[model samples]
Target: MTLKHILLGTIGATMIAAPAAFAGSVTPAPADPVVATPVAVALTGDWTGGYVGGQIGFGDVDAGGSDSGAIGGLTMGYDHDFGTWVLGAGIDYDFADITAGGNTLENMARLKVRAGYDMGAGLLYATAGAARADIDTLGNDTGYFAGMGYEHMVTEKISVGGEVLYHAFDNFNGSGTDVEATTAQVRATFRF
Candidate 1:
């Protein structure tokens, strides 16, 4: 072959091989390091404060037999929160006209201490305390109460809840009669 033919063949071969060589040597840019960012969720408000509320309930009183009626009252309390747990104390007064054994039971009051588990916008609690009940002819008698309750926050300042409580009084009015009561109530509260 003449020099011209040889030169052209060499040049054509170089041109075709150049792209292949470059393609083999080149690598894609390292994909941007996959960064893992944590996502956060919003939770409900805190439960550390003072509160005032009202409740209405119906209960059966057993003094020899059973008598049932409606009861309503006002409640006030303060709570301290510690992470997942809460502690509190409260007082309530109720007016009722429950009759059993030919006697009318009227006013009632309770002082309680409570402990609860915090559940974001809600609380589950248990309470126990001293109670006093007034009877129309038998005067006032002292007793004890225990209960469990659940409350849910509807707003930053308001909550709604329900509770079931049991009360027992032994040898009421110096007589041989005993009293036992169970109450189920719904309540609404405002927090400060």
Candidate 2:
């Protein structure tokens, strides 16, 4: 045979036989469909319930002079949130013995209204209200108070916070003395 005729015949025969030679070899099966796990979505907190908690901190009373001591108390409140703003009413009572000028003051109470900016897991608030205190030998006295506080939600039902309050009482029960007091406290609350 001529060289060109031989080469063409060999090439044509190889091409015709190649597919048949590999037809019995392993063929890959179609892959199984992948199943994906669903992801959990994070939810934001809502502060629209009644809460009760306790607090402990230091307080300084300046009636004529100044006296500083430790103070602890219980707090309870109900809050209504309006999107970014919150309005609430609360009551708190403290057991403290702060002395100034040989007189000891004990047992303070407050009826307060709170206005706050909601920060998702936290609150920045301003409070104004009425306060009352019992003097050692003197009767109970009433006053006005103003303060600011910050509270953070530790969980869905738990929160921790702190506040600084200034209280002013004029003519403390006919004693002819005006009382001005400041208190700083750390507090925790449980919501329902």
Candidate 3:
């Protein structure tokens, strides 16, 4: 071959092999940066404040004869939370008309003290209190009461609960009759 032919062939061969020879030396593009996603967590409620609320329930009074009826009322209270435990005081009034034999219960009121355990969004408690009951014929009488209750926070400001209370009164309104009453109530409250 002539010098021109040899030079052209060498240039073509170099052009063909240039890309393959430089392929190993070329640096690859950097990989995409790693991205981390955040995790979500649930929040619990705190119970340490004052509250006002209402309650509705059924009451059964055993005075000579058994008389059961519906009872409803208003309630207000304050509470202090100490981590795993809580304590509070409250007052409530109930309007009722339960009749048995010759006696009729007109209404009732209670002043209570309670202690409970904090369970995330819920509370389990025990209560004891002084109760007053008014009878249509026998006037009014003072008594003692004990109960158990469970309450849950439905929102930051609202709560719902249920309670079962037992009451005892001796010589109701000085009429020489002993009275025993049981009440089961559902309650809703607004917290501050």
User: What global local distance difference test value does model 1 have?
Assistant: 0.90
Query: Residues 126-181, candidate 1, lDDT per residue (tens digit)?
Result: 99999999988678899999999998988889999998999998998797789888
Count clashing pairs, candidate 1: 0
User: Which is the winner by TM-score between candidate 1 and candidate 3?
Assistant: 3
TM-score of each: 0.77, 0.78, 0.78
Q: Which stretches of candidate 3 lie over 4 Å from their true place?
A: 1-43
TM-score winner, 1 or 2? 2
Residue pairs that clash (backbone atoms under 3 angstroms), model 2: none
Model 2 TM-score relative to the real fold: 0.78
Mind giving the per-residue lDDT tens digits that candidate 3 earns over 78-171? 9999999999999999999998667888889999999999997899999999999998878899999999999999888899999999999999
Best-matching candidate per lDDT: 3
Question: Model 2, stretches more than 4 Å misplaced?
Answer: 1-43
After aligning candidate 1 to the native by TM-score, how far in Å is the CA of 20 from where it should be? 46
What shift in Å separates residue 114 of candidate 1 from its native position after superposition? 0.6
